[model samples]
Target: MQKKLLFLCLFLFVEVITAQQDILSEQAEISVLTIGPGALLNDSFGHNAFRVKDPVKGIDLAFNYGVYDFETPNFYLKFAQGKLNYLIGLNYYEDFFEAYISQNRSIKEQVLNLSQIEKQKLFDYLLNNIKPENRRYLYDFFYDNCATKIKDVTNIALNNSIQFNDPRDFKPQTFRELIHSNLNRNSWGCFGIDLALGSVIDKKATPEEHMFLPKYIYRFFEVATIKNSNKPLIKKSNVLYEKIDAPVPSQFLTSPLFIFGILGGFILFITYTDFKKQKQSVWLDITLFSLTGIIGILILLLWFATDHKGTHQNYNLLWACALNILVIGQLLKQKTSTWFIKYLKFLVILLCLLTLHWIIGVQVFAIGLIPFLIALFIRYLFLIKYYSNRH
Candidate 1:
């Protein structure tokens, strides 16, 4: 009798362990966590990740797709060429929350309204994605970054059953405007973005395309539904952490507009002095041409030589003409070629065309360039008059 009782006890223990494993799928919960933007330029767009929890199975993990291995070969070069590979990272949910909390960023979670099978499917998909070979993927700012990865993976798990309905407070916006919303126009980061990215982002982004931003992901997911049942996709929503209110110190002096305005003023002052003296300042012309020419070269490389889709079909070339570099020789000569005057005339026309482009919405130039553009226009006019009189 004692032996038989011992056998029964062992059998029950084994059964309990098996039941716990089985209950993981039934009791599991999956959620999408959206983190608010941070103070740094890199984190300005915020982040998104998937959270899977199963207390019965002792599984609580967050899967993030924003992980980039800096140790990879030619990391900086690949990054500049837009060939950087981002990888999926898995971490304990507690650690993930703590990291963002330390940064003082807000965290919101949307518990998905999915069946047990669907939850298991999503969990399995994430696990598979984190595998060594499957983890790395090409990252695109607009279409396939961290935020859009979550949306895509979730849709895949649901077998395209998710219907992302438009949010009640939705507004039509261009990709560039969406980006600008997260950035202060006067900031250097904003200036660099406006300088590098081209007119491709100026077009209106569709409602679904807005999910490229994490905040928009949270908003649209709130209204999304399952195609099969027409039921809401989010079972519950929770704010895991609320960012503390902190006063950001104003950086007015270092802003793009202020600095550019000073430079523009100096250029105009030089031109005015040159006009009064009736003598061209060769050094000033050299500096202007060299800078614009270098910028034009870089823009051309980014457009044609790199994989950055947003840099294609750039129209900033009108003002930062590559021909400026080729014409530097003529500027240095005592008697320039007859074509030099024609080139100056052509540059003036290009500047005028740039203004037309801005007015007609062909492209939106940087606000910081306003002062510089005005300065360039006046200088070009002065140059045209100067050369014509000299001839």
Candidate 2:
């Protein structure tokens, strides 16, 4: 009796699952039948050799059921069948580029609210253990799953000796010639897609399976350097600083102006205060003010979230620098007998040196990392001097 009951439950479960799958299949079919041909022209029409359907005229290019439709110009309007068909295409295409082997670890941690420093620490640790050869193996494994099949299908037209495809003509040839051909293709996206997809796929296939599409060809070409042994080590490119655009120049002035104004006002207030009558606990006052100012600025920056460009309202390093200045100012306000001024003056000079390092394209984390290291060394020297003198 127990065996019969278990069998009955299993039968019901199978029925439910089958029903769900049927519903999904039906939905997919309906979507492909509905969205017209306009979407095809927008996305895949010029890129692939496949047929694209027309919505209004009912003229089918490749498939009868699935088609693209445009609800508005420029904006991609959602269509059911169009998306369903596209998913099928993507599933097939993902087998070609196969780059996303691991779920992007950075993005996953971001959802958990991990700080940048924490992320960097984790990434650095992971990177150290993952040797260059292992990285190549991982990439090769991904290619085996995706690119090998694509290259096999596409390379039928090409000569067997070809390692890379010609951008103008999908002929197999040397990597240098392939790079030159791709660079000449103008669009980065075109190069990116072609290189990623082409690298993995097989070298020999019929024309229908292998011919390189014009769209997204440039994307694959530009990113070829990424795949090569010579990866770009520099994070910031010289091209970024070439143009003096809006908000950048404005932001530069804004930070300094606000800093100077408050500083000047504080100086005047101190001058006006009663001369010799006050018993000043200068060190204590300075420490308290600096602590309070730091806390206040941190709170403000956290709350405000608006930065120079206004493209994104986030508290980046610039906000931190501004806050640091305020804290330093507060520290300077106290008439302490200690060498706080000298310490701060040295820090300022160090910061200037670091800024110069960054401007000249130094391979350091922050703008003034080099200078910060120098300051630490100087501090160590001072510590040794103080101890030696006391002894």
Candidate 3:
């Protein structure tokens, strides 16, 4: 008799919780929360979340699809291979607002114009989404990230009835360009992105596809409409907090371009000195070969071994030849085989082709690599001539 009572109480508790989720108060509201970009590279693209509140129901919660735990098994490895699973996160609305506000990020809310039944439907969807089995999802930066989740989840809740209209004065841009809009071109972060990602991101994004960014989600949703009723999707909008505009201390001297330029200058100086003295710097050659070879191998892994689509068709490998690693023994030798001279010439040819690829827009490389690439071209030419004369 006691066991039966305990089971009955548990059932009642679950039923009551379900009932509460099944019906929202007439004063219930749903909105999309857009948080502005933060200073860090990871937070540079901004964020998006759903806000649900009801005074009568005493319910106010936030749901976002951006949560990822660093403690997850093989986190870095999975991230590199694009196999990491991100999670849907839940928070009290007050807590959510406080967190971003504390970080000095702007927060804007767009009150969705939804019917009572539609509001309940969306609320139900959010509750269902937070279940342990349903919470985790594969994250794609440009296609299915936190911002795109707002658009996707809304469409799902509304039964795909939204007609997204382009914002006023909207201009189409490539995925890479869209990302660049939020980044400093001279930043090391930007340079790393350019080096790691390939030409796949250069294709122009569709109007709806631009919602991949949180700011664009706000812009597009500002004019979005319900297809059947022709009513605006958003009832109103409010800026809860505005980010303070402040100048970021210039890191230009420490930036990728400056550092790479300095290194490239040193390499050129060494090569020039070697040229005039009728000698070669074996140690320098060995170092260059090792660095380029390792970089090439890593690029190959990203392109072929990993699931990263953006790392495909990378032309940077033309300059960073993986074969250079295998040919390091030739660099140490006082005299090299005839084929080694041909190999050096082939490397020079690869550099020429890389230039052609750049000119023809086959792939856009890192702008910070301009001086470095030029130095590499000259160095390869000198290496070829030196090897030929020595043989």
lDDT of each: 0.88, 0.28, 0.88
Candidate number that wins on lDDT, 1 or 2: 1
lDDT of 1 by residue, 1-391 (tens): 6544643553454345445544445778999999999999999999999998888877777889999877789999999899999988777788789999999999999999998878878876776676667879998999999999999999988999999999997898999899999999889998999889898988999999999999999999999999979999999999999999998899988898898899899999999999999999989899999999989999999999999999987888888998899889887888777788889999989999989988988888889999998998899888888888888
Tens-digit lDDT string for candidate 3 (224-343): 999979999999999999999888798989998999899899999999999999899889889999999999999999999988878998888998898999999988777888998889
After superposing candidate 1 on the true structure, give the runs of residues whose Cα lies further than 4 Å from its correct spot. Answer: 1-23
lDDT of 2 at 68: 27
Sequence-dependent TM-score of model 1: 0.94
Candidate 2 minimal-lDDT segment of 10 residues = 104-113
Give one clash count per candidate, in the order shown: 0, 40, 0
lDDT at 33, model 1:
100
Better of 1 and 2 by TM-score: 1
lDDT of 2 by residue, 1-391 (tens): 6544643553454345345532221111110111111112233222221211123323222111112222223323222111211211111112211221222111000011112332233223222222222221111211121223223322221222223323454455332233233332323332332222221122233332222323212222222221233332111111111212223133323333344345445443442341223333345335433543464454344334322111122212221233443544433442332454444454446445545533553312222222323333343234334323433
Superposed Cα RMSD, model 3:
4.9
